[model samples]
Target chain A: MTSLMTPKYATVKSAFWGGVREAASVPMLIMGASFLGFGSMIKDINWSISLAIFTTLSTWALPGQIAMAEMAASGAPLLAIVLAVGFINARLLPMSATLLPHVRHPRFPGWAYYGVAMLIAATSWVGTLRRLPDLRQDQKMPFLLGYGLLLYCGSPLFTMAGYWLSGSVPLPVTLALVFINPLYFMLLFLQDLKDPGRILAVLFGAVLGPITFLYSPDWTLVITGLVAGTLAWYLDGVLKARRGTDES
Target chain B: MNPELYNPVWVITLAAAVSYASRGLGVALSGKLNPEGSVVEWITCVTYALMAGMVVRMLALPIGALVHTPDWVRFIAVLVGLLVFFIIRKNVGAGVLAGSLFLMFLMW
Candidate 1:
């Protein structure tokens, strides 16, 4: 997407600044707070603030960072820690593909994509999905640039703050503090759609992951995603066709 | 390792690299992903659903400190949080605080 960002309207300078401006929304705040909680969790586990911020800057993928932080805290072996965190972030592959389609220009160098790839995460991706359709094809990159930068700068600060707080807080408060991250996600999705099939897919995925985890923890999300996503697709297709026929 | 002092650069690096690989893999797999047509929408939906679903489960059936509190109380807090968002006209921060405060209030 960075390649497509033209020198004409969406210059690198403007796009960088655009990313800064867009990050000021409520959703961004939710994401920032949640990451702050995560940062505290990392500090609670005794990870270095500098290293955690480094991960924030370079890794940018929060779930993966948290998984690594938790596993390392548990004294898992280095290789196992890497593998598990990687597995948790397997979803990013599709996310990049989706967002890349909108942002990538034919003339854009591959390396730009690589750099942009560093900033990808759930919060920015969600914002991009909502914002991309409204942007000119040429403008998408700047929008993403702005959005990504917003998150990029905010996350590390939150992590630093979280690291500072995790120790002084009590256990029950700490436990509740943890809930802030995931709960923020739920609220973000609350008004997202009137699409029944999509909503059903979300509901199914939500229920199936944990339930399946009771049997097979590692595979639950993959299994549930395949099952629920497939189900939602067909259900939407059938509904669409039925509506078409009735219109005829 | 004690829960209070370890350098975790290796862990952070592994995670970032892993995340980058996933993002790159998507670019490589784009041709096969098939975002259009019947199956793809469902796939995206399912994938999103799985993500959302896992989150809901985590909150609904939290394994840690949330376990110490009664399930009804936690669920009610979520409900109250959602209610306040509507009651106050869709404020995200308000809803989150309502949810957080409800939990804390129940514990109190």
Candidate 2:
């Protein structure tokens, strides 16, 4: 017998509203602008407007959606297109794993957990990570759900808006709109530099990512991540061990 | 190639399915794995590496409309954003706005 009056559930309402408030601000603006650019890009590439909105509604990953739209427009093979987009979105695997342990609760059913997991992306993942440390366990899930719901629903509307306004919108504005997400993520990465392992990983990955892209565009992400990440992890371990030995 | 293969409906559907499948698989694994272990630490590092790789690629070799903008302009914008981010005590929103608006101003 679950009671709504339990202290566990006490923070849920406030956490949800807090999430809504947070999403309604910077994250919402950023996502809307990014999706607006995505919609305009779809229009420019001669993809159907419905398809743009559909991709927003379904995948919600901007990079993967763009890859699919662009590749399909070039008449790339369907299997290849699927594989490329899948690889681009493969980052979500670790991202989901990193965030799930913080938010998963026995109070929520499995389906609800999976549903929220589907909505996790760059914006929500980073946002939740930054905020979760301050929130209670119960608050975390509702906050993420609230934030994800707003972002997921708001994106399609902005996508359609961008598609309709594509012609009238200046090229510079559209470019800036598209630039918002990457810039936001990069800035967030800068904030993440406090962690030594992550700092090394970012530094190594930054150098390797473009170099590998020149060699093999399709596998650049996975290759760079695995190699750079492993290197950083090993280096961090060595440093930690040496520091421990010195302390002893 | 089947004409239907390139259909917008099929393309969007399949792409969504593939993207969701990766994320779903992660969720399924999350329950079984111990988050505090070295494996999770490695996964977290990989996630950071992946994000860093993608962000760097976007800044260095952007596609579509961003391709037209000069590379230095983008570089300066990011530099200025980082500068402001630290100056403002790591306020992400202000830094992002500073950088984005700076790029728009340069292009304008």
Candidate 3:
């Protein structure tokens, strides 16, 4: 939810409407298509529809869920698979925390965001950040809820379609579907970079994580986020202060 | 049984429970932490930095399907997407779509 104090913004109704508009626009389509591919993967691998839907409802984090599903398909141990997926998603805690305070209604103190957040994903988080800054706090949650529900319902259908496509689809086409998941999110971040340090952070994190993963896959994200995040913050602060001094 | 062929219902159930509990943990912690405070402010910055790092990491070093795309191509697509996103007033859907389609068209 965004701060209502902002001078100009959308009403709760309008914000949710924007969410609908955004969800249907491009991200949803990409997600729908890719999830269709994922569904195909699920079915081809013989995971039940129930399991796939359960993944949607339960984990909700598409990247991690996909990792879990695909790794499991390859005969990875349940614990190891879950751990790997969980490790990837550990960034969500920070993602959620950074996002929640910016939107939690100061007046509506009793509202519980847990249930709503339980359904959140990397898609919705990126989606909401893209919209909610100019909306009221109250409007923020509803916008996310509406958008998430629409996207959520599509998962099973895509899964069913993907399962069908997996068998007959040519290898190149199949590769395109698989690529959509990460590509979808990556492009969103590129658009959202306002701070120069974030640009640096992205470069460092991206470069370091893979290099580190080659040596130790498990600790790559964890180590990269801490070191890289701190560096980004420090750099941003330094640059901002320098700008402030010049202005003064 | 080849584990992939059949997941015991318990595995699904346990995974769901754990996942939900992790989120609930975030909400509970949020209740205690004041968002406007200095530490929390710092944490928020850290979160953004971390998320940025993660995103960059994914583009720079993808695990599965993304690894196949050449690095320079991926980087250009992302940059193009960012340029479009800002040009279009920070529309996330447009930014990501343009970037992806750029890569898709070139690669395809």
Candidate 4:
């Protein structure tokens, strides 16, 4: 429910800079550490830093990138690797769709949505979902562009660093670096515990996800998402209806 | 023939295309649908569930180096981070840093 045309920032330039400044903080550090870990991962598999950088730029989604690299290293077929990565990255679809409502502005080029969608990784998506509501409609795209571009460019550098410093980084440090991604996500979701439905979704997924993984590792994500999400939605609707009746 | 399928360039190119197609399709689909509608909310719920599942999967049943650490340590570390995060008034960076360090310290 954003207005299609409304001026928020003085110019797209200001909005872009605003995003840049914001990205330079926590989002950048979290992403940098994760990519550093990824870089070292690819290096461990004897892949070149350039290839690591290539995947980082192209895939942008760390999960998909990791799946592709790991699967490729294990001699998985091309189609299998592609499908697995695609499946993992499918979360981006809903994220991008949700964002389009807010980020849409008359001044923003329609075609650029796809390009911006390319940059819609977990970190950016979370940042946008949390922060976009506070922004004016016009500022959304430029701000995202500014924020996304910085992380996008800086990631390859972290990857390269991870690649070069692969062996030197201690095991504990590397593991902790890896842990940062999930820890950040968990804490981020925990902080957003206000909504009952969303809270249920998180709880259901946390419990159901592990159970599904035991049976079907490849499809656990989709299965858990569909089952948990639909259940949460249904229960939330029932709860809302009950509350309304009680009020009456 | 098998090696060709695993070629880094081809693998990355095709994988990237496949991955990006979902995101592009989402944006395109949004133009036809109402953002304020229930469908969008359901999609959002589904997205959240999916993400939470992914994160939990990574934490509870991890791969590679993280597997070396006991599950209790990882879970406890998450609890510590959550506590820090809220106590610090939702400072995400500090929370994450605290959690990571706690994990590191425990492993030490």
Candidate 5:
């Protein structure tokens, strides 16, 4: 593995520009379409348009935002809303941690680290991870910041557009827009199937998630994630140990 | 029910803080944490599991307009998506387009 500190093909400026350039295409479309759907959904629920845009600006994670909107609309308590959104977004914790070491540089102040970390979302995290192996340490932070900034800034506009265009757009088209982000994430998971642990985790989680949902809608995500994930991880560990023993 | 309970400003602020707290905590811990440790491994598993759970929920038990379409149609669309994805060497855009168009057609 190349050292994380080495500068290969990117200075901060070039990497930032590179990130901006990369964000101009598919990621932009994905964010736009998803936020549009979110905006429309909020509108459908009769929530404040400003709130919808605020959710886009703050949470930035589609599922959590959607959960908050839905729950709030249903008159779920504020504490419940917070807990639900927090649990839905719990995945970001690990994602941020995983991506941080690659992007953190000593030259950047501690405050810069946290600010950049705030910008880390699924799009930026995945894009950065995929590209990080090829980038210099100096490039990682700027590239991610630039990429995240574009998506962050553009999302609210799309959200507002979708809010206004909610009823105007055909129902099927709006639904398709909503489906895009989930489908993209699913396919991305499928694309990277080499890791047995992750594959098992996905399979187990898929099987258990809805089943658990049938029991408790509010705690479904947290319960399914913990139970299925731990089970899969344990099973994978056992299998690996047995294989190692056999090989030895 | 108090109308203030549903106030957008308060709800959005609280929700945003809660969400940001998770992301921020991860960043705070990252510097001191070893990514390869067992704890990190468990966290990674949980994240993967959470993502998978959310995807499954979206596909099998969607809310809003998606609930209007037949479940089988959505399932078949996903299947066709996987098929196209493999056939085209895992081109996500093409695969997603195929799935989305298929669903739209079925809905129409």
Candidate 6:
């Protein structure tokens, strides 16, 4: 008889396949729609289909990919393009680091981290973090690999679809497709508002983001994130201390 | 060298390298940081805030075709989605579907 401590899956193959199955749901549609928009945008700018597919494979982050396209089109220098893409994707650093603890296992190969790190898009990061706790420790890494692989491979196809269907699709529908990504993210954040620090971060970001964007559109996300997050962290700390004192 | 003069292949190659570097650096750093420590908590908070900022920017000041829709229409769709989300016990997929359809309806 299997104990409660036993993992749901007996092997890595099962876990990985399970992850692929899990990903063939709403999250997959959200990512598909985003890439579809991206494919069309690249076509609109007359960029090659191969290059567009490469961006999905290599950069793997939507915002950075979009920034690279826009910057390149405007004839921004190479260094400028590099810096813009780097800063836009800096969130991946913290997100990957946070995820490491949850997914690490001794049986998992060390070299695989570098390869899998390429899959750390906002959707994968959030989905993995949210789901890992419910999974057995041994299952986490393989599951992520399965989930990431399916999306990573399937995204290029979606991009190609968007590229071919660009002018044929109605403009308003294409716009709505792009809008789904952010709308999904907003609702997901709302669903996860049980923690004070998280709640404060979202509230503060919602307030400070647009105001800061007016002055520095390129750096607004990082700057607003730093200031609002730090303030929320500090305030949450204070609230925790007060609660502790009251309990005492 | 004039920054304006560059090859497209080099641009894609360099951009990919820069993007991957951020993720690789995080993977390297993750080994050293204590998961339960204050540092991780701080990073978590920052990540959340960063995501929130991205979401707000996309909604309030969208680019491309989304720019055509009136601001109030987008905001109303969000409000409607939120209502449906709460009414249905925080179903994320439902919320997104409701909001997207509503936006399409308003913009249609």
* Winning model by TM-score: 5
Q: What DockQ do you compute for every candidate structure?
A: 0.48, 0.52, 0.29, 0.53, 0.55, 0.51
lDDT of 6 by residue, A1-21 (tens): 324543367787898988788
Tens digits of per-residue lDDT for model 2, A82-118: 7667766776776787788889778988888678888
DockQ of 5: 0.55
Off by over 4 Å in 2: A1-19, A44-46, A63-109, A125-144, B1-15
Model 3, A148-182: lDDT tens digits are 77787776677667766755765445544555555
Name model 1 segments beyond 4 Å from true.
Answer: A1-15, A25-27, A43-55, A63-95, A101-108, A126-143, A241-248, B1-15, B25-40, B88-90
Poorest 10 consecutive residues of model 5 chain A by lDDT? A1-10
Q: Is candidate 2 or candidate 3 better by lDDT?
A: 2
Please, what are the lDDT tens digits per residue for candidate 5 over residues A43-81?
777777888888888778877787677556556667766
Q: How would the candidate models be sorted by TM-score, starting from the highest?
A: 5, 6, 4, 2, 1, 3
Q: Model 1, clash count? A: 10
Q: What lDDT score is found at residue B7 in candidate 2?
A: 75
Q: Highest DockQ: which candidate?
A: 5
Which DockQ value does candidate 6 get?
A: 0.51
lDDT of 1 at B90: 75
Q: Specify the poorest-scoring 10-residue window by lDDT in model 2 chain A.
A: A1-10
> Which is superior by DockQ, 1 or 5?
5
lDDT of 2 at A141: 91
Candidate 5 chain B has its poorest 10 consecutive residues by lDDT at: B1-10
Which of 1 and 2 is the better model by lDDT? 2
| lDDT per residue as tens, model 1, A1-248 | 74465333356566556656667777578777777778766666555788878988877877666556644654655665566556557667777777787787766787787677766777788877766765666677777888887788888898887777666776556655666666666776676657777787877777786787677554555567677766776787788899999999
Deviation of model 2 at B15, angstroms: 4.3
Model 2: per-residue Cα lDDT over B17-55, one tens digit each: 988987888788875756566665676677667667777
